[model samples]
Target chain A: MKKFLSLHSLLSLICLLLVANNIKYLFVFIMSRQKVLNEVYYEPGYQFHTFLPHLKGVEKAGYITDLSVNRESNDGAYLQAQYYLAPTILELEDINYPYFIIDSKNTDFIIRTIKETKARRLANNEYGQALMKRPAP
Target chain B: MITIGYFLSFLLGRLTLDRCLKENVRLLHPCAAALLALVSGLGLSALLTFLTFVVLDSFHRPVIILVNISAIIIFLFFNRNLYIQKTIIPITDWLPWTKFRWFHFLYILLGVFIVGVAYVIALTHPYGEWDAWAIWNLKTRFLIVSDSWNLIFTDLHYHTHPDYPLLLPFINTWIYCFSADNLHPIPMVTNIIFVIGCGGFLCCTLYQIRKFSFPFLMGLIMFTTPSYLYLGTFQYADSLIAFFLLINLYFITMFQKTKDASWLNILGLSLGLTAFVKNEGLLMALILMFVVSVYILIDKNNRVGKSAVKHLLFTFLITFIPVLIFKVFIAPPNDDILPNINTSNFTAERFQILYNAVITEIFHEKWCYMWIVVLALLISRIWRAFNRENIILSIFFIIYSSAIVCIYVLNGKADLSWWLETSLSRILFSLLPALVFFGVHLHYSKQRGAHV
Candidate 1:
C-alpha cells in the first residue's frame, strides 16, 4: 500500500524546499566576499590548543585578571582566546591580580597599565600571558 | 574500575526492566538488543547521576554507590521472571560468517580497516579537537573539584555554555571520582565506545529490518564516512546525540509495526536523553514529537490510542523533568539566543553567507556525502511510492534539516561564516545516521516487498 506524500509529508517537503532556498542565499553572501572567503574559509587549525599551555601561567596565578584589550574586540584570535580560557580564568578570586599577554613591543604599556591600577607586574609566563598582583584593600 | 562500575549500573538497569525490556528484546534481534543495551547503559548511568545530584544534599561517592546497587537489586527482584527465560537466540545463529559470500568478506575487511583508521585518528588527538577540551572536559574538571555543582552554570563559567546538559561531564566526573586521576584516556575511551555504539546500532537495526549482506554494506557506509568517524573521535556531543536519535527512531518504527504502546515509552526515554546530550537535542526532541503526531494522525489502521499518547507524553516529561529543573532552577541564561543573534540583520545578504558556508562544506568537506544521498533518494522514483512505515522517518529528516538551517541563520555576534564553517558539518554529522538509515530502509523495503 503506497501512500505518496500524505498532506503531512507534502507539507514537510515544501518546508524543506523553503529551507534549501534560505541556505542557498546564505552561501551566496559568503561567496560574495571573494577577497576574504579563502582566508576565512581555510583558516588553518584551532588556535585554542596552541594557546592552551601558555594559559597555565594564568591558571597558576589563581586570580581574576583583565585583558589588555576588551573581551568583545573583533580581533579573531583574541576573541577565541577569551572563549577557550574564560571558564578556568573566571574562577580566580584575587581582586588584586590583573593579567594580560604582552610581547616585547607592548611590555612597557602593559606595565604602565598595571601601575595605574595600583598593581605590580609579576614575571611573564613562558607563553607571555601577563600577571599582576594588587596591594591589600 | 569506575568505568566498569558505571557500565554495570547501566547494564543492570536495562536488563532488569520487565516491561520495556521484554518488548525491546522480543521485537529486536539479539544483536540489536546487545547494541541497544550498550546505549541504554549510558542512559541509565546519566539518569542515576541526575537523580543523585537532585535528591541528595551532597554528591558523595558512597551515596551514589548505594543508589546504584539498590536500583539493580530492586529491578532484579521485580524482573525475576525474565531471568528464567525458556529460550535463547544467540547472535551467532543470526549472523553465521561461515556461510558469508565474498562480498560479505569485503564488507568485513573494509569495516575493520575503517574502524582501525578512525581509532588511530582518535589516538592522535586524545582530548578531542576543541569543544571536548573547552566545554565538555572543562565542565568535568569543575564537577571533579567544586563542592558546589551549581558553579558550572554561574556567570563565572559563561564561556562553557553552562545551559547545555551535563550527561557527558557527569559520567566523566563519576569516572574521575573512582580513579582519582585526571588521565585523558578515560574520556577518550568513552568517545570510542560511542563510536562503536553508533556503528553497531546501525548494523544491528538494519539487520533486524532486513537480513542480507545489506546491513554490512550500510555499516561500512557509516564507518567510512569521514565526518562520522572524525566527530566520533572528538569528544563532541554530536556523535552521542546521533546514537540517541538512531535508537529513538528504531523504537519508533518498531512501535509503528507492532502497534505496541510500550515502545512509545522507550521512544520517549530516548528522546529525553537526546535533549540531555546537547542543546540541539532539545530541538530534536520537539521534532520527534511533531513527526510522531503526524504519523499518528495519518495512520489508518491504528490511529494512536488516547492512552498511548498519554503514556508517551507522561514518560517524556518524566525523563525531561530533571533537565527542566536544572535549567530553570540552576543553570544560567543561554548565551546563544540573545546577544549573539541580531534580529535586525536577518536579511537576504546574511542568508547568502549562511548558504555559502553550508553548501561549500557539503561540496568540499571530506565527509557529509550522506546528505547528498538523502537528497537524491528523496526525489528518486522509489521514494515517490512511500512505504507507510517510513512516514515518521521521512518527516523526521525534513524537520531536522529545516531546523538546522534556521538555527545557523539566526546566529548572533559570532561571525556567521566562522560559526558555520566550524559547526555545520558536525551538525550535519549528527543527522547522518538517520539519513543513512532512511536510505537503507527505502532500498530495503523496495527489495524485500514489505517484510518487516
Candidate 2:
C-alpha cells in the first residue's frame, strides 16, 4: 500500500524527466543528424558589407535605390571580417539590413571594384544616369 | 561547471512535494496541463535545433533544448497536481476551437488591437538599426549560405559578433530550415512575434500580479517608449532579452507564492536564455545572483543564504554553459575579448580586468549612465519599501536589476562604452513585469478589477 507516492517515487519521477529530456540531446549527437536548408551562392564581388564584402556593384545599386538589407542581401557586417576594419556606417531605415563596412583596400579597392559583375548589373539597370556616377579617381 | 543534470537534480530536490493547490478546488485538469506543456516544449525545442542545423548546416548541442523540455515537464507535473488548478496555461491553451465567451472576447480584443498595430509596421517596414543589418542579418545570411552549421565556431569571421547569443539565429534558422528558403522572412516574423509576445506577456503579468483592471499609466509608458517601439521593429536582441527578463521576473514572483522550487530553476533558466540572447541581461542576471545571495544571507537568519548559495552556483553553471564553451574553445584568442567574464579562465589577472572595466565605466559615465539612474531609483525605493517593512520585494528588485548592470559594467572596457550607452537604458523593457509589480498597488479589499 505504501509502495507509491513516497519521496523516492518523486525523486524517481524527476530522474525520469531528466532522462527523457536527455534523449533528444543524445540523439542529436549520436545520430549525427544532417539537414540541408537552402543553397547560398557567394561569388567574390565588391559589395560594401561590414559583415561580408560583396562585389561593390551590388552595393551601389541598392545605395542608389535605397533597398533594405534583406532585399539587397549584402547588408550585414561580416562577424569577424578583418577586411572591414573601419567603423561601419550603421543605418536604421531597415532592420533586416542596416549598414555596410568599407573594405580595407581604401582608394585602390574602390577603383579596382568598377569591373565587378554585380556592379555591371547595377550600371545596366540604372534608371539611366550611368555617366552621372562619379569617376573612381 | 554544473551540467544540466545537476541543475535538474537541484530543482528536483526542491520541487513542491505536497499537491497543495490542486488538493480540493479544481477548474482544469493537471494531466492535461502537463500534456500541453510537454508537447509545445518538445516541439519548440526540436524545432529550434532542427532550424539551427538547417540554417547553419550543422547540428548544435541539444543541451539547452533538452533542459527546457525537462524543466517544463517537471514544472507542469508539479504545477498541475498541486498548485492553482488552472489547467490551461493560456499561452498555448487549446480553447481557440471553442466559441468565445464575453471574457474571452475581451482578451482577444486587447491582444489583437495592440499586437496587430505592431505587426503591421513590422510587415511593411525594414528594421531601423544598423546593428540588425551588420550583425544579426549578416550572421543569418552566412548560416543560410554555409554548408554545415558547426563551422560557425571554427569560421570566426563568419559571425557578426561572436559574443552575441545564438537564440536569435536559431529562431530564424528554424523558419529557414523548414521552408528551404535562405532569404530571411523568419527573423522578420520572429521580431514581430517577439514584440507582440513581450506586450502580451507584460499585460498579463501586470494584471495577474497586481489583480487590477487594464494598465493605463504604466502600460502606456512601456508601449510608447521610443526605444521600446523603435527596437521592437528592429532585428536586434536587446528588445527580445528585455521580454525574456520580464517573463523571468514574473515566473519568480509566481514561484514565491507556490513555494515551488521548479520556479527558481525556471527563473534561473530564463536568465540563462536571456543572457544567451544578449550580453546585457546576462550581465544583470550574474550581478543579481551575487547581490541577492548576499542580501539573502543578511536577512531571515540565513534562510536566503543556503538557497542563494545553491541557486547562485546552479545559475552560474547552467545559464552560462554556452558562453563558457564559446570562450573556452570556440572564440578564437582575441586579446580584445573580455577574459574575466568567462569562468573557465577566471584568472586573477583577468578577474581584475573585469573588475576594473565595471567600476571605470560606472563612476566615469555621466548622468546618462543607466545603472546610476536605475540603481539610484532602485536603492531609494528599496530603502523606503524596507522601512515600510516590504522586505522580500525590495531585496528581490535590488539583486535582479543591479546584478545585470554591475556585472556587465565591470566586464566592459572603453570600447564597450558605445555598446552600453546604446543598450542599458533602452533595455528597460526587460523590467516591464517587475515594474508592473513595483507600481502595482491593488489590495484584496479593493474589488478585483478596481484600480487605485
What RMSD, rounded to one decimal, does every model reach?
Answer: 8.7, 16.2
- Per candidate, native contacts kept equal 0.03, 0.00
Candidate 1, after superposition: displacement of residue B180 in Å?
A: 3.0
Note the DockQ of each predicted structure.
0.07, 0.03
The regions of model 1 sitting more than 4 angstroms off are A1-105, A117-124, B16-18, B56-59, B85-115, B209-212, B338-343, B368-371, B381-387, B446-452
Candidate 2's error at B345, in angstroms? Answer: 26
lDDT string for model 2 (B410-435, tens) is: 55333334445555544554564355
Query: TM-score: which candidate is best?
Result: 1
Docking class of 2: incorrect
Cα lDDT, model 1, residue B281: 86
Predicted structure with the largest lDDT when compared to the true one: 1
